[model samples]
Target chain A: MKSAKAKAHTNIALIKYWGKKDPKLFLPMNSSLSLTLDAFYTETEVILDGNLEMDQFILNDEIQGEAETTKISNFLNLFRQETGILTPAKVTSQNFVPTAAGLASSASAFAALGAAMNEVSGMKADPTTLSTFVRRGSGSATRSVFGGFVEWQMGTCNEDSHAIQIDDASWDIAMVTVAVNTGKKTISSRQGMQLTVDTSPFYASWVETAATDLVDIKQAIRNQDFQQLGEITESNGMKMHGTMLGARPPFTYMEPTTIDVLAAVRQLRQQGFEAYYTMDAGPNVKVLCHLSDSEKIQMKLKEAFPNNPVIISKVGGGIELLS
Target chain B: MKSAKAKAHTNIALIKYWGKKDPKLFLPMNSSLSLTLDAFYTETEVILDGNLEMDQFILNDEIQGEAETTKISNFLNLFRQETGILTPAKVTSQNFVPTAAGLASSASAFAALGAAMNEVSGMKADPTTLSTFVRRGSGSATRSVFGGFVEWQMGTCNEDSHAIQIDDASWDIAMVTVAVNTGKKTISSRQGMQLTVDTSPFYASWVETAATDLVDIKQAIRNQDFQQLGEITESNGMKMHGTMLGARPPFTYMEPTTIDVLAAVRQLRQQGFEAYYTMDAGPNVKVLCHLSDSEKIQMKLKEAFPNNPVIISKVGGGIELLS
Candidate 1:
């Protein structure tokens, strides 16, 4: 048996990746940018053995259900097709995230899996090849291939729709993750994105504006304009979620406590703390602000939500293959 | 003094009236449909006196400030120019709706004002004429001039962009309004609408889809297809609010309690109830259902929100000029 292990950080989109132009190939309708966070990540190990009858998935030291195993096998098939490896593999994952908080755990999970698979296969693929490969597992996983600030250009084809690092994010930037009380999310990101694309009236507009937002947010990063970056990030995320509200069955990820968290972030801004909020396809709200203010903001959020956990995170590194 | 009093029921747009093509003339970008409710209304008396120094504005039996007076005077000026009446009228209003709840008291207020002014000036105007006249004061008021299910056409110019009754809504339709707890809205509807029109990436799509929704809902009304009507009404209203979430400075009217009410409504749906909810530019949620089920739904909502108020309303009549 030949095995390899890798770890990848979770990335949160500043310019969100929403609908896909091609779902099978994972080609996005618009480009997106994301920031890899230090707080949460996933470690994945892939073992290749001729003795294995079928692919096995182990998650959090426990055997996963058939659904989870099947998804992993399908994702592994993408690598199998590319690397010409026919032997099934045992895949193990340790996800260090608030399990059902709507955080993008799939991002790190797939990124780590892709990296470990590449290592196990003795494949020295470049960033673009790795990004496109992992994207098949999850669209947002495209950005988790790189560290700091990364932008995934929505290329017209599968090969070109790859993520590239934009900035090292050495600035004093931070995010306070408010893991608000959330029930199991009914609408998965894949289902929500497809629904928005197929039925939302605002989908076309979302695609168009997201492209512009990618450019604007990049410039904000270049200028080290915290306020501009924060505003664009918040606005872009809101617009992404906004399209979901216009879907055929019209759904929103916001729960009651989510609104309360947002109001608290706005209150922080009013009190001279430059905190801005961004939400993904779940009820949890993340506040982006200066690293110096993160502890204070976390304290404030704690007061507002005594029972919830507020974690502050800084910039994280790119995927790493363990020796 | 020549005076006429009129009473108008507040109409809540199903295919919501959002944004404007011509703000000055109050020409909506997309046609909308609404259901007038009997529970809330406004009474206005327009007193035309040739000897009065200037227009005197009174609201809810109290004298209004200069800002309110100026707005009323401007609305009156349109009538003055068209009817050749130079008299400065005393406009007194009795508001029977929740103030600042975003229940669209302006719809009834403007409709009644338009009717009273027409009667006082001896103008035997048709519904189209009255709709166009009232629309200058408020856009949704165009539908308030008619009763039951009304459609306001988004005509190319001022004259054509008027409302007409599509159905008497005598098919046992009813609504249960949930007045969720809310703070004073940070952004007014007029300001929010303009922001959405000017900045929301989804604005154009909203206008286009809203037109389609209007057409489909009107046909549903004609066919008495309760399911189709309810779905379209709920989707359209959600789309309208969705645009605001994509605005430059994104905003949401959803409060914490508002989401709870929506959840409660969804729970009712899960329990095999044919109840759907819609919201305006306020934190309140109104559930639409059959008249036979309204009381039951209201009871359920009351149980969910024991401290809040839930009121049931039926189809309302058109604007009436009280002799």
Candidate 2:
């Protein structure tokens, strides 16, 4: 059996993609688009052999437990049944990027693993087919297959629903991530978004509005309209979060210091700086500003929050196959 | 001069009443409505004797500072000037309600003082005039003059912006307050609401959508539909807070325990309890359920959170003049 390994990095959604329509099928409750960043990525390798007693797993250089192995095995078992490999198999994964730091690492990891597994298995399937298998593993992972500004088209089923690239962010609109305290939330994004979808009256509004906002924002990015892009991104993110606030028990990723950072950003805007901020499932803020203004804004932010290190990177390249 | 005193409790809109076409005239950005609680009420006494030295204020049995006193004294001074009073007046305010606890205490305090001042000056103006005067002090307080469920008409000018009682709490809904750790917020409602109005994009959405919710909620209360009333109140309040979340600096009144209470309430609903919650400027959670289920829900809540004591009260009566 020939083994193949492929590594990919997942992107964080500036507008935020939340709520799965079907948890089983990984169909999203709303269509979401995100920018694939180059700074953080994930890598996974897949080996196909019939001699394995049972499916073995390794995540981040460590063997996986039953919980981590189920997603991979289930997808593999389904894929094997579709192909003719009825015998048992082994799957191993290694996530190279930051683990569980509120940035999406698993999505890329699973997407790469799915692609590699398909490659080694010689399944004669396309990226979308691999994406469907990947979606079952993790919903947002399906989007990691494409690069640039990708929109996870919420399909009715595995075949129709997958991610598509909207625009290459390589030209402008840098996503500046300010590194704050890194601690995983007690409630996972899956649990939180599910609770909100089940309980919040505001959830439907977010679902309805996100489609329009995503389309408008993509257009703004294409036009290089910084103000429109900034405004739309901020509003869409806030709408996604508003559902969480209205959830059965409201929860937020906002830390006390997060407000201070926000205040500094607003102060910068008041001082004639054209910077806008969008935050995801964490306390740290991501500012969407022009590439030219990034340095000045980063300097101002550093001065305001000396403790937190700010990293500035422009639109990243698409998923690259590493040797 | 006939030294008469009349007591009035102000109304605080959970939906928020901010912005004014005419600040001096007290016109609001939107029409707001609220319910008056018997547990919290304010009493004010005013004397229009011509021998006083400027406008003096006695708040909570203590003489207020010139600056602190000026908020109320200026309104009184304006009224006195209009009524052709030659001497400076003295206004005494006794807040017989919760203070600095995000309980709309300021609204009740100012409304009561405005009513008393009007009465002492022998101005037999109707509720409309009284509300306008009270609104000249604080926007929401204008709605408190009318008992039961009052609506502050966001008229273009002083002539139209006044509070009117929409419905008496002749229904089965109960307001249960759960006290969390009480401390003054870094931002006061006056400052916070102003910030939200100036900076929040969602502010317009709140202003546009909340009025319809308020009107529908009043009808739902009149129809004695607990479910509709609870749902509307919760949605309206959430929409109001949504604006604050989108405020440039993004401020929230939610604590972790506040979220816990909300979750517990939802859990109760899932457990076959008919309960929903609404929150205001404070971290406390106020559950709106049927009067019959109040004790059962409160007991369950107490069991769930031993530290937080839930205060359950039936539909409270309007303000009564205590001589």
Candidate 3:
């Protein structure tokens, strides 16, 4: 079978996706908006080979163990069922972003894998169909199928639930990522989300508030109101983390450095710069700002966190076939 | 001019009071529940001395500066207005707890001062009247007016809002205070609460959810259900902090060590102990547990943070005249 390689960039949720309504189908409890970024991405090559006894998976040139390989194999089974390809696949993937550190690595990873599979299987599916295929691998992956600002609609079922692009983000907006800890988090996002859903008393409220935030943010983007967009993004993220704290055996992904970065962002805004911050289920903080203020924000974050890594990323495109 | 001394113990809120509806009256946006602890207490003496030129204030044997002296003097003015005593008083106070480190030192401080003023001025106010009096000095102090478990109702006006005893806490409940940082927090609780109220988009939801948590926790206390009480207490504290995180230019009182202590508390609960943690606007954590499990939880926390001070405290009494 012909081999195909594809690339997909990571996306940071402005309106966060924290809980699941249907875990088996990977359906979110509320719609989420995200910005696909250019700085970090993943590339995966897939080829179906009848000679292979079983599926082989390599990540960043390193062979994955049973657990990682099994996850990929099961994910690929979805594609196999659709295209009627029974041959075991050899998959080699490389991630430029940090994994399991709230950087949305799985988003790019699965989106690329899905795109590569679509090509190798000769499916020629549209972006919407590709989003559904990618989402089965990771919920956030559905948004990575489109460029700029995308929203993943939390439809009642699998078929109706998919991502739609809100804006191309060709405006003056950009993001600066402060990597407090690029290493893997002790608790995975999946585990943390599940814990919050099962134990947090405020879980239902979080879903309701997130839905409201999604609507507000979409309107803000349509109106090109940066302030409203930033405000909703910051509030939505806090609500998500709040649910985690209220969860049974409460947990927090924020470290002291994370707070420091956020404080710096606030200070910048106080100093007449329009900047706001949002954090996911890890220690890193991502600041949403105008493209003009990106360098200034990056410098300020670097000065505050001299030891940590700080990177600036522009809005990125959707999944692409890399021949 | 009869001088009187009174003692009141510190109370840590399980359901937090973060915002103010009437800032001048010190009325909270939501009712809060707290447990008065035996470990930390404040002693204050008040005398309506006609010989004094102005109100004098001393804390822990140290003559307080203008700001602190003024605060005590202003609080004393309320007492003077009620009892028709225009004489400038001499106020001396001592705190056995760590001040401003999220140990609820102000709770005990104002409660003791209220009791002393009541005695010296001869107001003959009961506990409910005394609660309203203490609330003017500090909101949490309203709860400190009573021993055992107390709830500060978020009344519509100054007269109606006051704390009442929820339960005697005569059961197996106890608390272990982990002094993660004994130093004063840079952001005072008053300042922090105002910032959150003004800036956080989640502030309204926090108030609503806290009201629900208050009802649930009070019911749990009535049923003498340690598990339910502990669960609601932990969730309530997290929700309060989550609001702060959503604040514009978001702020968090949680340090790295604070998260460490919380993780330890969760581990303890997982190991069959019913330990739960609650925090205010400071980095320190107070763990609520059964009297039987208190020692074990303290030992475990001590093992985790060898440098920090861990003190166990049981149910304490209401304000009492010491002289």
Deviation (Å) of A258 in candidate 2: 10
Q: CA shift at A285, candidate 2, in angstroms?
A: 9.7
Q: Residue by residue across B191-235, what tens digits does model 3's lDDT show?
A: 999998897666776888788889899899888988899888987
Question: Alpha carbon lDDT of residue B127, candidate 2?
Answer: 74
**DockQ winner, 2 or 3:** 3
- Candidate 3, residue B208: the lDDT equals 82
How do these models rank on DockQ, best leading?
Answer: 1, 3, 2
Candidate 2 stretches with Cα past 4 Å from truth are: A9-11, A18-106, A121-139, A142-239, A246-323, B10-22, B292-310
For A1-323, candidate 1 gives per-residue lDDT tens digits of: 99999999999999998888888998988899999998899999999988999999999999998999999999888878877988889998999976656789889999999999988987769877899999999899999999899999888898899999999898898889998755678888888898999999888888888888888999999999999999998899899888988998899999888999999998999999999999998999988999999999999999989989899999888999885
User: What is candidate 1's CAPRI-style docking category based on DockQ?
Assistant: high
Instruction: Give the TM-score between model 3's chain B and the true chain B.
Output: 0.98
For this target, which candidate reaches the highest TM-score against the unseen true structure?
1
State the lDDT of candidate 2 residue by residue for A20-63, as single tens digits.
88887878887788877666667666666678767778876688
As a whole number from 0 to 100, the lDDT of residue A89 in candidate 2 is 52
What value does the lDDT take at residue A231 in candidate 3? 85
**What's model 3's lDDT at A246?**
65
- The iRMS of model 1 comes to 0.6
* Model 3 / residue B295 / CA error / Å: 6.5
